[model samples]
Target: MPSETPYARLTPDLVLDAITACGLWPDGRLLALNSYENRVWQVGLEEARPVIAKFYRPGRWSDAAILEEHAFALELAAAELPVVAPMVFAERTLLHHDGFRYALSPRHGGRAPSLESADQLEWLGRLIARMHSVGARAAFAHRGNVDRDTLIAQPVRSVLASSLFPSSLHDRYRHVVGRIDRLVAARLEAVGPVRRLRLHGDCHPGNVLWTDAGPHFVDLDDARMGPAVQDLWMLAHDERAMEALLEGYASMRDFDHAELALIPALRAMRQVHYAGWIAARWHDPAFPAAFPFAAEPRWWEQHIIDLHEQADELE
Candidate 1:
């Protein structure tokens, strides 16, 4: 509970104790996984293979919301999709010990998916479509939706409040963010009312783990409600890439062509959100070490320029 490090109290001993509390015996081997919002680890076990233990960001999600995420992942797994749902130890998924909440999943190994290949993109598109097919079945009562407020406004507010934000470009940052807020809103309005289903919420390439068997969707921690296109846009970079994605997507479910226009808006929102996330987390010790550029005057100045250009594209 240190002011600077969110996971300061989550030492190796605490991580091990948390897992053992779940009735799993640890073998004293822990490999820290690449995660920021949550502390994840590959914990060795006594009688079984290693498991991925994810310690949630304290107070970020209500218990109900976290359960909603766990439920969604279980649903996808039940549907025979390649989602890594939390393991049910003693019929419970959410485990608690030493004042921290965490969940454990059987570890699955895979390298990052090669996004440059059409085969890879299409394969991912189909899996996502099938996942979305399940996502459309029901709505999450606790988890929020993907919208301008969550993606753009809240993050902008966080950035503006940051001491790390370059004072010289403060006004410029505000002006550019304001333009993006308005332009993104207008674009969504013009798209008309589209279906908002449960989404992977953060479906970028990084969240996906690919194997020869296909993609294993990891990290439903960002799970929420959104247009199906929200999940598809992040996987495709260019016009052709998006087309390839949709080609595979269409194989399983229908695509709302209107959602295609929502891409630029989503992209702008994500750009804004990333800056906001860094600013909001700057107080964490890990943030400074991982994103040293946040403290640089030039980075903030260039960020404003980049965001201004993104706002223009949204227009």
Candidate 2:
């Protein structure tokens, strides 16, 4: 068996073999996709077009949790929303081969959605509202929520434990993060208890692919239970953009104006969580290669400044 850091063992040959084991004929053409947490490949089929194979990051998510994400994507697809769901094989979406768990999905291609366009933003808003409508129907049994514990507290713990975090900056990092933590907590308390529902948890524009047919959502790996605004804030860049999104969202479902207040708090949490994410994954070669800037002391200095800025925003 491979160690926890198994990507070293997941060579091109192993990836193709995994596909062949799943009854698909690989044509020996494999393109590594843009993914860090999981190893994703664009593999050409024997006689058919290409498909995407996503190998789950070992120890990152349990089987039940991965299935919960798959089920949620399937649910969104069932509603006719343009979401890329895992392709089931032999009555199962989660398949195992060579000590790794993976799933296959048809390759859906499109450029990034134009967040600058009001019309496009509105369209995305409606889609998100519809997704939230279905998302509100039920809760995930094995999946977790997007909250302080998952995004902030846990990440703080991870960074502190990680050797990647510079010992020289330890006190500075702790002080800034501690202030941001208190500020975030106070902001959340000020917002009070807002509605929580299943969300696309990481709804950045990069996840949305825009084609003539419209936007298709990809990568539900970060999906979790959170406020509906968690999905919307990432899409809106300014007040006008947000207004357009809410306009479209209001057309489908009632928009809770109160959720807007949670955006800054969410942003702060994401900032903290992102640093932690890089720290936790620094052991993985991909992380350091992709985020070379994170290794510099100046980066940590700037990060401290950013955290302080976020604290000011919260205040």
Candidate 3:
């Protein structure tokens, strides 16, 4: 049973021990956070406020890639941005305990950001622009990119390899995914070359924590090199909201109106990638519990239909 998942050895005791290893005392309270790619928790402390302990998924990211993420966060924080940078221990941000790589951060609380308010959307856009300005200054030598391999090819491979994919529909799945791969690639090619920079990578509303002062970004774990639009598309819900966001963004950095053309292509890519992510992670106990529908044949059927529809939109 221990062989079932990579996180099998990450017990609560191990989590607390990891905190202790970093010279902090945990108060025996552990709350598992909402994360599927990696194991995260809110661990209490006896002498200080609660800290977030995130155990990295084995082999998902190399040590250098993880350090680059931490360095980016620290760089943003040093610029007086509200991003939560990881706490350093023994002069290192990335640390190890019992063969697991984990990091700690101070907990910040906030509710879902209200995108309905144009002012708020503009505010978020301004912050994103500022983040992008810093992101543009450097390149991530060890990180991945938001490209065909990550969003399309690799995910399609996962879905095709997944046991949960309906065996009867294997041929059909391949046809749809392959077509999507081609369409997405062609669309990206048509868009010409867009400026790629370090981005929050997954900047949906959830990653943002709002306070009385304003918003502070959390979870730079997905940070990587990509176009600036990758950070903006998720925060804006509609044309009006996007306009307001761009208004603020324009005040800070130049916007590639052409990058807007990539939105549909990017969306199609995400649709393909999301299914692959779920299928690839199905072995993780949390994924099954969180995505029970993925276990059913109907889900696969619907997924194929969705992919077909995505292709239509792309065309």
Candidate 4:
């Protein structure tokens, strides 16, 4: 059954027609990739290699913001960093068809990088350092900063406004996030004015693909301006792992150790932001299907407990 959501009009026929309009003939093979924020597909071509088509979620980002993301990926690729840059079509990267905006990229395949290996961690660090070197050369004009307002305050409001959050836990949720907000603010203040640069905002293991050649970064959808540690902290699991990454990072560029203190705060912000993200997307059928646990009362209770734990970590 076709979803009655905003994407109901995005049928497979529309997908094929959109690609055909882009000057590529579809082979009628489409595999829906693992994505919820936006619809992505592994589309086969008539006589050419398969390409990935990413359809942007409506009302999520303005055209200028999306273009900025493309430019950053291109900039990183131009600097010889292993990032998947959008495939240009007819002198442009962003394309429009059927009231939707999308981008095409050549399909590259690899498995998730092994984070347990010190060597791999160091290698990833160097890659990130190089990316930051390019990222620092310019600032985003359209994309907002990854600060308290976007990561904490706005998300809290979304949760409060949404019905997905259990009514019984409302006061507890508000109190927990309120304390976390203050803690995050104090932590940022203590860190002082740190150098902000373009970052792979959602740098997690899933975004990294490891092959014989090394790691290749995919998806600049979450790219934004923030502290360099925002890109590095998620990749590190512990002190030793962090040391390995920083060791390689220091070799390529200067790193401020002070950003280390911001990790726990950042982690807390992510927790709050994640729940908000789910709540914001509850209207989308894919969200409920994939995150059924979010609907359960026990899950909300556990979420509250997790927030308390994060608060303790912040102190």
| Native-referenced Cα lDDT, model 1 | 0.90
lDDT of 2 at 271: 95
Better of 1 and 4 by lDDT: 4
How many pairs of residues collide in each model?
A: 0, 0, 0, 0
- List runs of model 3 lying over 4 Å from the truth: 1-3
TM-score for candidate 1, residues paired by index: 0.97
Model 2 Cα lDDT, one tens digit per residue, 1-315: 454366888899999998998889999999999999899999999899899999999988999999999999999999999999999888899999888899999999999988889999999989999999999999987789988899999999988898777899899999988898898888888878888899888999999999998999999999999899999998888999999999999999997798898889899999999999998888887888899998888898899999999989888
lDDT of 1 by residue, 102-196 (tens): 99999998878887889888888899999999999999999998888899989999988999987778789889999999999899899999999
**TM-score for each prediction?**
0.97, 0.98, 0.97, 0.98
Please give the distance, in angstroms, between residue 181's alpha carbon in candidate 2 and its true position after superposition: 1.2
Order of models, best lDDT first: 4, 2, 3, 1
Query: Where does the lowest 10-residue lDDT sum fall in candidate 3?
Result: 1-10
Give the number of colliding residue pairs in candidate 1: 0
Off by over 4 Å in 4: 1-4
Worst 10 residues of 2 by lDDT: 1-10
CA lDDT, candidate 2, residue 224: 92
Per-residue lDDT of model 4, residues 187-261, tens digit only: 889989899999999999999999998999999899999999999988888899999999999999999999999
